[model samples]
Target: MDQLTPVVPDDNKQAYAVTEVTPEDAGDVQVDVHTHLRDGVQRKMEQRHIQMIALAGTLGTGLFLSSGKTIAHGGPAGSVLSYILTGSIAYCMLTCVGEMAVYAPISGGYIHYIERWLHPAIGFAVGWQVCIQYCLFLPSEIIAANILISFWDQAFPKARQAGYMLILMAFAALINYFGVRWFGESEFVFALIKIALVVGLIIGGIVLDLGGGPNHDRIGFRYWKDPGAFAPYHEDSGFGYFLGFFTNLLQAAGSFAGIESIAFTAAEVKNPRVALSKAIRRLFWRIAIFYVVLVFVVGLLVPYNDPNLLQSTGTAASSPFVIAFNRAGVKVLPSIINAAILTSAFSAGSSLMYSVSRMLYGLALRGFAPRFVAKTTKQGLPVVALSIVACFFGLSFMSLGDGASTVLNWLSNLNALLVLYSPSVGFKLTHVSIGYITWMMIGVTYLRFKKGIEAQGIDRTAWRYYNRFQPWPAYWVIFWSSIVLIFSGWEVFTKGHWSAQDFVIDYITIPIFLVLAGGFWIVKRPRWLKAHELDMFGNIPKDEDVECDEPAPKTWFGKVINFLFT
Candidate 1:
């Protein structure tokens, strides 16, 4: 039997068209007219688009709104430390993803990688796990949007707020319905606005710290000294300080939530090998400048013990930045920052729509979902998959009943937990969070990929994109992430602090993943591929056939803009 199965065309489905294979390739493979990409999607997402979409998805409410919570928990110095550590882990994991993505540029990203390197059942499970993650994630963005919008007026009516959310939902659907290029372009603009906001906030933070605000109160690390670097948690002891730091570390994981999504856009991005490499290299800087530096500024701006920091106003009033500004007698900037936060939330929701639909399309392509889900429009938009995912936006309306902040916490907790549990090790061992699981999966998958290359004698030097640092980053992720996961829920197990909700939130994805992967394994009993048997070439796009139509900018201004994005 041919290793590659032909895609059976449906007259009602305009997603894929059949293509004739060359004489040499005829018996061994089947080809599609859209073999350059997948599910009839076009390679229109430029390098800038890929970079900015990741930025748009990641730099949302976590930094603008929730970083205050981090400061309240971990104090100034402790929060900075926590963010730095999480940033390192994110950097290492992204490099592992980049190495694989640049090589194959597959549509499904890590899900497909897990299937090819390990077992199809594992991929099936992880794919749906992430798909479900985004389903929950979409509503959280809207919930956050409501919080930011309410900053303008504390008396904002709830019914009107819900209506506003629906409008944002409709906006996201329209952009995605148009096509990936439209989604990419929209994200590019949104990301730039977010980038400008962070940069401006950072510079303004320095000015405020140096007594440049109207109040002329030089804060120059006064909060750090007053709070004494680390805030105590539960009890005033070394153990308490440790718990504070750990709590901040977990929250930092939430801030870095969508970092790995760049891999998911691999197939649709123009010049996947080159574009992904550039974006991956820049990923570290993005984390460093936006998250780490901005978080450091946050600590300087507000004291850990400030009463306003804990006030869940569901508005910029609770943001450390706005709180700092209010104290410094600068009133107008809070409104401006609130506006940026609102846009950030909207941008995040729109990006989630694009990501979730693409994931569903990928699932259908791999036969993990119904084939009809893969159907696309003439323009290559995955209309069917998108429509199904769009229904999930209605879940945002849950905010109307529970209150925006309450629903936001529930969704945020689930998403933050998911970061630890991205994908796990063969469903064997126990005790980990969503973020830890994500790191472990990427590490383990990369390790398996390396082993396969060695066992199969595949030459690494010939690959278009290669990371010289091999198994060490993978090892670093596995060892540290395991340690974090094991101790992540320690607070709950401590004296008089056990909460069922906390415990469940920390470890819930384990059972959920087990049910999904194990159920599939029991039913299908999919064969695990041996290293030598891994079909590395069959799914890879032919470099010669991939058209690099994106032209270099000629004008000096265009060149500068291109350089900045790249």
Candidate 2:
């Protein structure tokens, strides 16, 4: 038997080597994929980078720029409940993904898992949908970054905005074009800045509410009471408040959209099992502190009826935190927050571009795309895939046109597809008053994964990371995500609130996915695998995991640093 030619660089050859087996010798799909593709990629992302990259993707403009919209629509209590409800669902869904990602840590993330575990047609629909989602979403983030820069001067002309957009796109392209290491390090720094800003803003919000700010005015739920805990949506009755809460619920989903980037990069992390496990475990706290707490504080500080809440300035000026600070007679914080959000927007765009490129690469590996797209540079950068996906950045120029809002609406409408169709995917859908069919697909995929594992009799103890609550998390996600996906467009159904364009945009993706998936199913006529016969172990690259080991922290300080950073 020919010894497998190790794919690592010369310096790393002694540290990493595969067993004696050629690609042809491996009959299993996983081994063949491993022999051919897995080792071509470099594992440069550290544990800290994995944690923060997930943060970078999730903590973007939705929280900083449009969270105020949630408050304005739902009022303080309604908005808070919306975020809490959505955040819980997101947490559960990530745990399901964590289990699969930690086990295999494959390149394509959940899309690959869905293909192998569910039907390939389902995977095709999902993978292409996500690619479409990010292609549109990447420019939207760049457009958002341009808007963030406008915080300094809302009067900046379209030409100037176009210039800023160009600069932002170039920076994002630079970050991703090099490799995952650059992507990881950049996101780490951006995530830290975002974390600091959100923490400071949360603390600042507390101070402003307690009369500790320059105004010395005690806020203490005054806004909630005056706004009466719930704002009417499209009417001034009981049904109106329900609509308000539901609308905000859908919006909150958008804020949590890109959290699943962790899964996509799992294959590129230094130590997949340990690093991904740490990131997944800490995700709950990150979401609660960064998102739930921040929104709650914003609600306490700003009333739902604040006219500025609807400003849509696309800058810090419209941010609830910024609004609260200004009302408290503090002026300096807005600029600082705006700068941080600008970085956040850029980081999100860069990260989304990187993720979709990897998704396209995975698609190529599955024969869904051209084989040439699967080729990577020596450093394992998917150059062709990156270039293809990066082209969509041109769409950001649309935001500089006379019909900027209309352009954004079109891009956003297409982006409503999910990370697994995360909250961001749901965000685009809800933005147009549409249901989240793609988001529901995530839950269905996870259930299929769970069913396959059980049917195959896989041992739980041997897994790198096993989520504490088994099947329940899958069930939890499916139930609530299904409810939201189905009823997400309920407001449009109200008697006085009908629009054909809105209705079509709301549910259009449903059929697009159905046609793609169904057509693939009909043409290929792929045989369904019994749960016991599923290829759960085939695609897992055990040799890839063996090539690297992260040393444990020895000293107390090292341990503390490891705990905090990891």
Candidate 3:
């Protein structure tokens, strides 16, 4: 009867009214039946689970084997300082990611955040970047494991390396196949074992330095003094040394690649809002105390100039743990530590497989990848995704042949860029303050909130959450990110004459991702640009009410103040 009323059919059938929807209302519409709505997905991971997963993912071959390379590049002083610097960057980025994860706790982690805050193109770019990084990492860890196992040269022949690698891969696959809980539990036990070993090593190193063992030299600062406070690799001027420090910084950062696993597990964690924050805070301190302090201690205990340190590079025997044990006159301990190194490598490789598969699954869910990858097993395992990832493990076998050296070098180069670039984009996309891409989303969010408040005639007092520090984080993020971006490009151009291979390695991946992202944008511009599908935060239907809506003003001044605040 009225303009708003729907007309009934002749047979008295009910008729549905077609309502006019605003663009804002359009985005709020849900399509995926399984998409998380209120509270957004169930949180099942506990604090211990998160910690152990992070520990398992992070405490890997990097500590045991890679420190030698870092020391070799930057000298002990430079290496230690570089690690500290990288740790600081990691801390900042983790904090930024923590803020977002605490709020949304999406299964896709930063990728989803990237999509929400930035463009779908950016998210697609980073998703692939992470996927590729983790895939590359799988092979690197496997190769490291193989090398570590070779410590018992006679017991474990080089010929059996491939076979053993396969077995290990199969074992890791089985563990991961069972589901997240089983994977978390396995990582928990492995992480505990790794942590215990590290503590023992630290205590043993301390005791050895105190003259408790046979080599009774009271190591103290002797190594530090002999190495002249730091290992100076560059023969050039002060700037050369400074540049070398950054080289080590990049390497150290690469070593800590998996540290962000804490954020990735946020979606599955129990009480992620609280647990993720705590884990992030703890991760900062843990990395500082364990990695930075331990590396400092190692550098002091074992002189950077030691022949053993030089020889350990690119070999299982190159691990500082073995060298430290040998220096301390612990003949059997080196063997024990070598075994631990192998286990750590296996753990790292296993974790890589798990992470990459999940990332692929996330990509598929977002339509950046094929839909088949989104399909999961009854246990929620993305079986197709896992299989696709498992195929990359075969790349590890390349290390078994004579081309191993070339493969290692290329992998290293590719890995270095992969590690640096993803975080650069991630920091860029997250609207975090650490990188050049500032929180454009904050401005967008604020404007949207203001409009919603105006539309709903809500008062400012009703606002629940507010950010005191605005634009500063965004400013720093943009400033620093720009610096790093420029630095990366400059480094390539200046050093291009040194090695064309290095130039290609450093610069190629970033552009490839950019092009891919651009292509995706061009193809899906319509859907991607849709306000409702913009991937802002979690796509919560009530975001306007929660984030933007305000209470009614009590007076004109109150309304004016609310307008000013908006």
Candidate 4:
């Protein structure tokens, strides 16, 4: 009976590995070598799969549909600048994540890094933050899809919307159950479809702006002059315009939320070192070109004050894409764009499910959650974790009764505190739309353990990956993220702008995060792991043991796809 129990150890490195002591003929307590115990996830995602995971996880309703709202609020120029600013923040975060993830190459990605490198309590907090964030996020996507369908048929039934969400969630869960390869391949296709939509829209927008389409009416940035490149905010003056720009910047930041998700699959991706670095290298340009540039061009093609831009039509038809095409006299593209948007939203949900399950599995591995959640099938699927995460998808049904915007509001509150961008759709909850996200990031990255890695006798040069500017980006993430957290909600304090809803969205998560982290501090009273005490090698794969598991693509097209995309 004693053989089946695990031994608590003072050393974290020993505590991890999740080694169970089993007594056999020797009647001794020893670590078992079960395959499931070795590594709880499959390394089936290839380089291309990593790229698509990042892309498919992002590139959804936010950029495709909601940029219209962003442009209306910030104006075209303001919106682009905001995107660049936010994209830069995302770049810093992703690179830092890449540097750590490649060196660690763990399933939980940053969550594992937080627990081992910083403090377990903070890891506990972040784990809950991420799980709850995606739980709300997955349903928000479902609700966004429902809103999209209703735009097509404004009277779309609530029951039908709930049914659609359930079907979408079930399908996403099914795809995840097949394991990483299945998820990756499906996401690869999903990413391609999303890229095609954005590219096609850009080309079509260019044509319409230049008056090259069949109707031949030159737009040529006329909207920028009329509605102007700067939209007035709470006031018509310079400061008000700045407010508009800042708000739009926050919204734009929201759009880029899950850019770091590729790291979540680091444990599952083949050749995580190369795969991760490659994904990080190519990501910024895509954000700038596909998101910022496309939003810029959308602003150019359509006037921001167009009635539809202000209205939350809840469908891709309501997207600047459909609005611009139709205004330019293109009739048929809206339906096509809407269809693509629906798929994009669905893709986001799929990615969210995968990330949430894996993150939870990681948490379980760290003993933060039920150990059963860490269990996996022979295929390396965390079935118990997936089942638990999938159950939260029912929250999307909140939209059917209360409305999508309302659910988005509550979800948005938490997400904003963390600078979470839901691909593009808002994470609404209980009629609240959260804003602000940098301080939360600061909390996560401030106690980062790079210096500890050096102390662990690991050679910095030998590390598979390193951020170009080692400590600077980490420093920036710490400083700027905190500033965003503090100032993002400042508008509510203005004399005329105070509102209960605004305060909730702007600041609610701050206290919740503090409470979680603080509560842990109170009970456990854990100190931040100092440099020498960091667990550099805890349950992590040795550098020499790391090797690429994916085979080279065989077909000519496959090779080209891998080369270009990966």
Candidate 5:
């Protein structure tokens, strides 16, 4: 580590260089990685867009559409409680990520820092896992959009429906092809529409629940009482009720997937430290308001036993939100909500493709993926990575053979396994129930915080963004996360419930990551990284490019919009 070399032509470029990690990876240069793409392309995501992306990415088919399935499995009370608990765990991980993101604000985000603090092999495994999940998710979401479109017109030709998916996928690539700005702006508009839709739905649900619609018959909590707060699946009441709760726990995780996106993509966001701190600070309330509150309201309106919920009709007919509106005789709301669902689902596909492409590029730069994958356009988009991910749209063809419904289930399960590898996901909540992630985050948080103090001398007083409760929250998160993870797959072991597919799907990632990472470590033979030796700032750019050039909104209406959206 002599004097740091410049990564870009302009000295004003961030002080990002090929950092040195453990002495063994590449001797003088740490883990071998391309320094930075300082091609004069600025970080384009505005502070406002940051707020909406976090909200919009998570509010997808899971919340507006699939919540009926969760309610069917876990009942209303159980589902609501599960989201609260799982959301708490996700918050802990997000905050842990936030503390480091503010300090370094790099592209690889948590995984990159995890490699520096934990092991390089672990970092590599996690990064590639993220790429795989996004790769899988990108196509699944496209297929989902196609399915949702069927709700409006069942007679629409399947081939043409698929053609629409391709066109939409290409459009998404173009957004990322341009840069983060396009991705940010597109999601901003998408997220705003969704926010308005959610707000409208909540108000309407409350009105309908109170019998304010044309029917004018106060239903109150009539559905919850008759159906009770719990629903037993095929099993006995005691165990069935409990298993359903576990099922809903995973559901909540799926809904809030990408909780770590803001932290991971901190590199591309302008004013990373301040923007991320605000986003993370507001994250919990967003989950509670958009998800928890919505869940509570939805439960009060729709019963767990609704035939529409249990049928899996693959259309707006099955959505609890739409079901409630239909029951209330609301003429046009269902159609509107269905349309919003389409846009949101499409937006999710695009955003995930964008995220995975960047993750792939980051992996390539770190010497994990092929060097060509890291190749980018002059504007800084990972064009090669984008092309590879976009090619996954070919997977949509699987729907033709097995049917879209069957292929979607397969992709969802695969996405779950990869969730253990990649923290950024919104597919299945049960994935979070696996618990290993919780313990891993706790270990990383504690080790990083301890090492940061002894090594970098970081303290909350000076560091604007730091995880709260210090070493304590990490311990609690580990405790709860472990319990959830162990029992997450426990139902599969039930006497009559054993299913080999369930066991493998739930626990598969544990061995895959361990063996790959362990094997890589053994071969690399990096110096034994001691706890105290962790470099909290090893990868941090020496001089951050501080360009808060976007002018703030000054008008009264603009300020109001900022308060509502941001």
Candidate 6:
């Protein structure tokens, strides 16, 4: 058997050895050895694989099921604004993450970055928060899947739900167990189906607007015009409306929670430099086109005050997509939409499990978790960590018996602030880099020149992809994140009833980061920091050292896609 060669310079090399074996020989090895081998090499996920994972992460019950709630809370105009605003924030954060992932794609993703740049305690806390969020997603998805199934037949619905949940989970486990490529391929196909459905819906919506459907009244923005163009949910003058807007903003931000999944997959991606860059570039438009544009079209087609919009309560049947289909008088569309929702939920749940398990594995590697959980399978699957995550998901099922609305609200509240916090803090810290800091300043300058850019009719691909309009999106992130952080505590000061939730969210990020940093400093204080091991914002390497040596595409089709996308 050939030993794996170290990729770094001899002076920087650590005392680790790798032994490779054939697949037949692999089975005969002890489980511990298998685990070690799996954990040894960093699995490089390909471009399509990253795209598939990103698609699965982004298209969830949130778009279908939760968009209505955002509409109801913010009204039609405010809802659209909220999504656009939050989407901008997410876009900026992803760009920052892209730059880092391109530079050094690691399996641990941000958790590893946090550990290397900040401290182990901060990393552990972030890891815990991420894991909790992902695990909670499981039951939420399961309940959603169950509700979708019941739409077909109520007979033995609960049993069907349980069965489907287990089956989907097992399938995810099997895919992951084989290796990264299998998971990527499966996700790719599933994601393509979703993208097609969405595109078809958008086109159908346009046709319906043109009065092509039965009983259609040339629905050319009648909902918007009749509803007074832009319904701002708050009539209160002064800061009151702003306060309401901020609350709605948090909810909107939460809807885009999983956008960071692109960052999570950085480590596993095959060519971090090209693949990560393309993924980040695509992310901006995808959110703008799929989420922002879709929401705009839906709002214009369906009134915000529709009874169904307010009835969501986190179930698939409550989804605006179904409501829109039903409104369009499209018979049988609801069932198709429901089935799509089921697949979307399963994909999201699988993604959650993968993210949480890898986070646990990262934590364990850093000694923050029990060492045993760090063990991996010969195929490079973190079996023990994955099992723990699965168990946590099973435990989340207890929340099912709790009132669905309450459970959903609690989960929503818990996740809303934390979701934006990680990326916000991560970006701000990453901006400590000279080039990134320069971009941040340039982004701010560009925002001031927004009017000029708009006047020039610059294509979105140019403005958003190139960040040409100055802080095209980063400024919004800084502005809104600051508002949420501050005003989350305002009710306590003004109305007297303290919001523990607000405090937990607003104050949690810094302490969590500090504790992690402090712990790492106390324990394994390295004699010197390795350049490759530094966090996003740490000391910038010389241009030569910073260059990435990504592998070439294995096939012609891959090379073409890579060329087009990159």
Q: Please give, for residues 1-566, the per-residue lDDT of candidate 3 as tens digits.
A: 00111235322122333444454453233222222211122333445667666544577666666676566656678888988876765655565566556655556667766665556677777678668867876776676666666666656655787787888888888877777777777777788778777788778777877778787778777866775665554454346566667666555655566665565676555555555655665676678767887777677677766766655334446777667777777787867776776777777777777777877776776677787777765445678888999888888788767544555655665565553322210011111111122222222333333344445554433322222343344344334445554465335445324566555555565566668678988987834343333333223333332232235689997676444322
Query: Each candidate's lDDT (Cα)?
Result: 0.75, 0.74, 0.59, 0.71, 0.69, 0.57
Candidate 4 per-residue C-alpha lDDT over 413-491 given as tens digits, one digit per residue, 9 for 90 to 100: 5565653446546333222122234224533553356777666665666765666577776766666667666677778
| lDDT (10s digit) by residue, model 2, range 103-165 | 777678888887877888988887887787777778777777776777776688887887888
Q: Which ten-residue region of model 3 has the weakest summed lDDT? A: 424-433
Taking all chains together, the TM-score of candidate 5 against the true structure is: 0.89
Q: Which 10-residue window in model 2 sums to the lowest lDDT?
A: 418-427
Report lDDT (Cα) of residue 240, candidate 4: 72
Writing each residue's lDDT as its tens digit, candidate 6 over 321-363 gives 6677677786767777778777777777677677778778766
Mind giving the per-residue lDDT tens digits that candidate 5 earns over 24-50?
222122122334333223466788788
Candidate 3 residues lying further than 4 Å off, grouped into runs, are 1-44, 155-159, 312-316, 401-406, 410-485, 488-497, 526-566
Error of 2 at 391 (Å): 1.0
Candidate 1: worst 10 consecutive residues by lDDT? Answer: 421-430
Using TM-score as the measure, name the better of candidate 3 and candidate 6. 3
Q: Which of 3 and 5 is the better model by TM-score?
A: 5
What ranking of all candidate models by lDDT puts the best one first?
A: 1, 2, 4, 5, 3, 6
Superposed Cα deviation of residue 435, candidate 2 (Å):
10
- TM-scores for all predictions: 0.90, 0.89, 0.76, 0.87, 0.89, 0.74
Candidate 1 local lDDT, 1-566, one digit each (tens): 13333466443222323454442343223222222224467677887888776554578766787688778888888899999988888888888888888876867778778766767777787888778877877877677777677776668787788788888899989999888888888888888889999999999999999999998999997988997788887764458787888777767777777677788899788888878878887777888899999999978988899877776665677678998888889988878887887888788788888878888888887778887887777677888999999998998888888787666665665564553322100111122445566667878888888877888777776777677887888888788787787777787788787889778766677776778789989998978777766655664666654548678899998898788786
lDDT pick, better of 5 and 6? 5
lDDT of 5 at 466: 75
